[model samples]
Target: MIKKDVLFNEFLIRNATPEDAVQMEYVQQQCYPTLDPTELLNRNHFINHIKVFPEGQIVLERDGVIVGSASTFRCNFPTQESTFLESSDNLWITNAHVPDGEWMYGIDMGILPEYRGLGLSKEMYTVRQEICKELGLKGQLIAGMTIGYGKMKEKMTIQEYCYALEIKKFTDPTVTPQKKAGFRWIKPLYNHINDPEAGFACVFMYYPVDDNYKLECKL
Candidate 1:
């Protein structure tokens, strides 16, 4: 458990390295306990991510412990539908990560359950936007989990659920926060992952660095 003073006094958000792989993996597991084992990234995956895009891997530390993390890579706007595995290069981020791509694709972000609601996610999103501006990229993109879907599946269809979210009929554990952080839903993706909680679906979202950028939505 983290001390109370540490939360208000100081917390460090810094670039992740190979050494942080184990801790990052632990946080990932904790954040998505229901995710399929194969869908979750491992320690080796984190190390590979750091090696491939060191600047895009970041971690939050409170009292020297990594309590949160965000992973990303450069990629162009998706012109076709893609699954989480395809978009993230099967979690290794080696094949699809482009050096000079137009968008900063967020692969994953996790803050320990006990450490959430502290504006940590918002801070991370801010950092990601700053990175976009610094690199002159268009903006950030993510296949956000619809974590509230499983419970609502018996009550409503996936499409209906998404519509409710759009109309603010209800809130989602994952998508709501991202929306509050300024992400806009581009579309809904089916079979995006193996999470039964999300009905194996996810929402494709984007946060443009500025208003002038437009999505070329070929779908």
Candidate 2:
């Protein structure tokens, strides 16, 4: 038990441990079909993350089973620029973490099928945002997903679809919920993820850890 229960009915969310890799791997495989399972983190990776910044890694537990996980690391990346991140391959290289980077890069967030649609994802993002604020991080860098684009591609251009999403006319299953949690779609990127659901591209988004949320915190 990590002291903070994060009570949500029968669910509990807490910081992850290196020992959680097995459970996290299972949840990742079950929830994230678009990602290559082989690319998923192993024990060593989880251990490294736990050592690097355990505050940024969170897991949701229900009935003594891990149902969701979120991974993040301090990274050197342009928050306001459309830089093309090639793949997840080079990003997870060991010892490549920047402990004091200006930005906190969200690496992954997933929830088991049985645990979906219960506002758990929003809870995880809230945890991440809290961690960023604690570490004095500037902003969050997420390659947002346009999950509903694949089906809509047949009826509209990618440009039109993204515009619709941007203007609140429509919402995607994944990104829209995240947007509701305060992330903004800043730009689009190529090869950000292996998923085609995003039209082979993912939106680059930025979320600030605003001090305005705290009464005594200064901007």
| Top candidate (TM-score) | 1
In model 1, where do residues sit more than 4 Å from their true spots?
Answer: 1-9
Give the residue spans of candidate 2 off by over 4 A.
1-3, 7-9, 37-39, 79-96, 154-157, 211-219
Residue 207 accuracy (lDDT) in model 1: 94
> Clashing residue pairs in candidate 2, if any?
none
Candidate 1 lDDT, 1-219, residue by residue in tens: 111223466787788889999999999999999999988988999999999998889888887899989999999887799888888889999988999999999989999999888878888888788888888999999989999998887888778889999999999988999999989888888888899988888888899999776776735
Best by lDDT: 1
| lDDT per model vs. reference | 0.87, 0.70
Error of 1 at 30 (Å): 0.5
Backbone clashes counted, model 1: 0
What is candidate 2's lDDT per residue for 1-219, written digit by digit as tens?
232455445877888987888898788777767754555566666667777777777888988788988777777665233322333324353344577786677767888988678888888787777777778887677877667776876787766777998898978888888888788666666555566666656677777787353222211
Q: Which 10 consecutive positions of candidate 1 have the poorest summed lDDT?
A: 1-10
